[model samples]
Target: MKKIVWLSLVVMVLLVLAACGGGESASAPKESDGSASGDTASTETFTYASTSDVVGMSPILTNDSVSANITEHVYEKLFERNIETMEFEPQLAESYEIKDDNTWVIKLKEGIKFHDGTPFNAEAVKYTFDKLRDPATAAPRASLLEPVDTITVIDENTVEIKTKYPYGAFLASLSHSNAAIVSPTADQAQDLMKEPVGTGPFKFVSWTSGDQVELEANEEYWDGAPDLKKVVLKVVPEISTAISMLQAGEIQFIDNLPTEQIKRLEAMENINIEKKEGTPVYYLTFNHSREMNQDPEFREAVAAAIDRDAFVTKLNGLGVRSDSVVGPQVFGYDESADEAGTAYDVEAAKALVEKNGYGDKPIKLLTANRDNFILMAEIVQAQLTEAGFKVEIESMEWATFLDTARGGEYDITFLSWSNVTGDGSELLYPNFHSDNVGSSNRAQYSNPEFDELVVQSRTTIDQEERKAILDKANKVMIEDNAVVVMYHGIVTAAMDKAYSGLELDPNGKWTLKNVTGE
Candidate 1:
């Protein structure tokens, strides 16, 4: 019966994956046929799949995962990323120079205009920054640019930004979607969720709420016009529904294609699958605020009890078991620390539990009420039980679970963090820093030394020095039982052979502005 349940789950996952796989289907424009002439003639329309609806269109409040994928096409940032190298490249800003350690002089590209016909200039840039810093706006990503002390309009096309302290990652942070510039005349009174205006290769046309969002090619774009005229983002959460849409000519591209469906799609001559190593890390976090977990020996015991190799092999076949919160893809990540080993040892876990007088304590595991998370919770529960710990599972909705976890209401919980930038500093500040406790630090773990190391790492310009600090900080976090690191996520995308030019940024965002269809 146990085998049957596992088999059933596997079969269901495969079926969902197969439905999400790509196929040659009829190409019909969803909305706004590109009859605009000029460069927009080559490509007519494109369709993409998303699992969830965008939370909001305002860059400040848009925290939903799907919003980045959709808004990226309709907005442009100061700096873009080089797809191959993952380095910062010029976009709205043609070039920038560091006048001093804490000051950046940025030169904006001339003659660039927003979709509302407002000329893009230094004043426009300053206005955007002012809006971001506005207390009333309450931008979610304000922290990313908190170092900026002031924005000075040096000239028509030049702006100078002074930071409170030297920040080595400012340029890279500009590549974030939240940094995307909007029109100066953008309706500050009207919620951007209803109407979004930006200066990108695509223009927002309409959003059908749960069904689809439509965009039209921006013919007056400063950069060359996008080849595709109309782009439609279909919200289909079920993987099977996405695959069926691809196969039945309802859509052209699907993101997050399940791994099990790869074989079936590969067999289909008309379908194409593009797989890229993803940067999302899925892991379990322990609520260290609880008395039972506050004991170092108890925490160590729990860490040693779970077999990471088994989880990686059985639960995440396409991912690597992470020994630390930082993933291998992140720049400055230390593989040596991972190689030192933290694999499961039943005897060691039992010994630690006995040494800490926590042998008979009941352990509670908390997780969001998602199918994948439930599976993971069940696996952890079984593993810890075998190691002599009494385990209980609690499930809640994603939002409730997040709030509860942040409030330190659980002993252990299945959680994941998507790295904003491909930087280790991003991982440390939000998860391990003492200041982030009761906020981003859901574990409620705190250490003054760990906090100091994090601050030092951020201000240090020397790469080696920064790395040493991060390495030490990570070790400290592990020793403190801040959280048990699990596996990094893998992104599998399925698209029809005709679709082209969809590029994945190093930050793991799909840019569809320049995407075209043959």
Candidate 2:
């Protein structure tokens, strides 16, 4: 709650496993109709549980994965990120041809229409992207599409786009949900946040603020109707409750499987677990804007004090130990980066802290209130204290925490940078480049050399050359202690074997169009 073969990264999001609770009502609210109920299992209905409700349905307006849980089914992108190959594949558009490094021509599929009955054509593509790039719209994902200078329609079935640069990740960026083509007719007809309109396999049914979001089969779906007639995403905040409900046959899926409960879940008679190699790197970043954190020596001392090995061990099977900034699944990863940071040594760390006089200054450790993040923050707090440093931990709600951290108000904060784009440029640009300082680059790190390397990687089309440039740039980040590389997360989920085709990708995203429940 992670690439750019159509990959985009989020500043932080866990894709929490929202599950159903037996203690809570398991049926659709009395006002609803045509939705399957968990009280009785059926082939036509599927229920997936999550810890919280989605932010909204308008794909471009929201960035969190919680909202994606719904958009993944409701929206359709011109190009799709193949969950298996991690490559960009054609979806709404039949095919694409690169005219040059800065230009691509796309041919669209005919006879396709939005859920609202609007024709899916080149005009729709231009309209959707125009809104995405409009400064007034202020779409959260607008920055990712900045590479594209303009999109011009060649015909009803074709469109040509030109980029400001070589833009290596451009095609992959098309696979993102934010790039989903929306119906101009419907978008102007209603508030998309409440009733999103798209050409997906399922239609937006109903959303009860904190309770659930329901979707039903779009019999007119361009791809053909989904096997399941109805799908429900329920909000159940407690993992323990979700586990109990799964055991009772009240819910069919748990998207975010907690590592601490894997053993217990494995013992369940009807449960099946699956793990996807994740492309996210969870790290601790020192705000370079802060005077004290600007000291490379102090940052190195902080890195040396905490033990990443033990930290990952505590993750159980949720992730793997790593010392690199980019995840192994991402294209820019190199084995040499494994030695980029200082190894754990408490005595050496203590000596460095004392020598740097950072021990007297207070280190405010900020983190979201997620269980694993808070646990790690506490663990690091103890380690830093043991190393003779003054550390204090503060936990905040996800939204507030995101704003606070991104605003560069904290000394150091935990950040889970999910490199959705499969390239090294994804891992480097937003997190380290000076241009994104007040936004994605929460670390407030700035180095002209590092910026040049990232820009070079973006303009370089050859994967080998880009990887080399990114690998070199990453060393500069690690050497400067821009952020403490911790571990790579593994996407885990548990489900009743009665359903299939709901497997999550490395980024923990799932497609429910083919999912069936019996």
Candidate 3:
């Protein structure tokens, strides 16, 4: 995230920052009241400080959070989760009916048009999803629709979904950003990332690679025109500089704040700080490819050695320790599963280590060279050494770290996952399912029993039955000790008080919609 396209954009940033008056809030809300066709919501640009540039605009292909955040405004999903109430609501689709355990019928909202002026109908839905289902697309999030059998357009405005199984998380999965409807005209665009067209609150204007993305309000938005005329997501990798920009009012909003600077942000006038209960979990995961790590007892021993409480303390009481990464914000989060999990017991760990006889072997703990991960790794290393284990630490750049960890090149790695879909199936299916061993399931964990339970949880239609199945699946994995969850995080963000209607999700992601800046 420290990457800055500074050499070329230095002059541009200087010019922009100079124009941004010291302590001047978000650009004026509007010239007119945004009620008429000629009316524009905001006259001046409203800038947001983003830690990194968006990876891509193609919703199906984009895997990173920064890109997804940008796309959320530019694209509309068939269903959307209410950030406040945690309920699923229709966006592109008007309504849906469950015909049976394996079938669903949805009626599209009529008269909607994409930014490219293509009529949004059943064909558009079929086009986008067909691309997602296509193997050539190589969509990273394709697993989110693994149970889908077919998407059939029953009529111009109606669509029928047939799942291979009775997938219970289908509705919740549709709410995911990956399920966004793209314009059929998007296929004609030479560059998918640069020329994204969607039916959303904002339309793309420009994307300066690794610098900023500019968007203008969609006055023709089906929901009605947003109160803001323009939005700019600027890449300012340094958190300190971003906070300074917030203080100077050069930027209107910033998220994923450094935990240390949150108090400083809270003290700033006209700056509103928001902390939402979230589902992002940073875990110390064991790579089951290693012989020593494959044993459940040894894995449990390592889990018992680490002090999970110390992690929160190390972060200055800024995080929540979770026995289960399935946080309260997500469905099927079992409180009892947490109660049944292991606790810190140095003596028990030492005994297990001695019994396992792998204490003399060097156990490498790999992590990215980020400050937070390094700090947590040091703590883990110290505690494990104390419990009669030979521990070694390895840190690499973020990109290299991902490549190494995802390929099962490390014994233990510091990693994180956000169950943004608000479903336990999202948590289990990707992270634990043996089928995902080389992909999202970085741990290389393979247990047929655990896999069966997760699949069963998703195939069941009843929520209670699914939850029970998920609870059991979680217990099975917890016993196997594939991962030692450090903590579930809070989504921290800073926005000028002049702006309202900024939304934050439980995955530490913030979105802008209908924001009115005074």
Where does the lowest 10-residue lDDT sum fall in candidate 2?
A: 10-19
Backbone clashes in each candidate structure, one number apiece? 2, 17, 1
lDDT of 2 by residue, 1-518 (tens): 22542233332222222333234444433213322233334556678888767778998786667788788798989887777788888999899999999999999999998988889999999999999888788675676677888899999999999999898877777887778989999999998988999999889999998889999999988777888888899988777788877777677888767767878887776667888788878899888988888777888889899998888887777887777787688888888888778889999999998887888878899988776677789999999999999989999866677778878889899988666556678667867888767766778999999999989988868878988888889888888888887788898888776677775778777787877655
Question: Which stretches in model 3 have alpha-carbon errors above 4 Å?
Answer: 1-43, 350-364, 369-371, 388-404
C-alpha RMSD of each candidate structure in angstroms: 11.9, 12.8, 9.6
**Would you list the C-alpha lDDT of every candidate in the order shown?**
0.73, 0.81, 0.81
lDDT of 3 by residue, 8-83 (tens): 5887888788887565434333223221121122335678887667768988877667788788889989998877
Residue pairs of candidate 3 with colliding backbone atoms: 42-229
Once superposed on the true structure, which residue ranges of model 2 sit more than 4 Å away at CA?
Answer: 1-41
Ranking by lDDT: 2, 3, 1
Worst 10 residues of 3 by lDDT: 31-40
List clashing residue pairs in candidate 1. 19-243, 20-243
Q: What would the TM-score be for candidate 2 when compared with the true structure?
A: 0.89
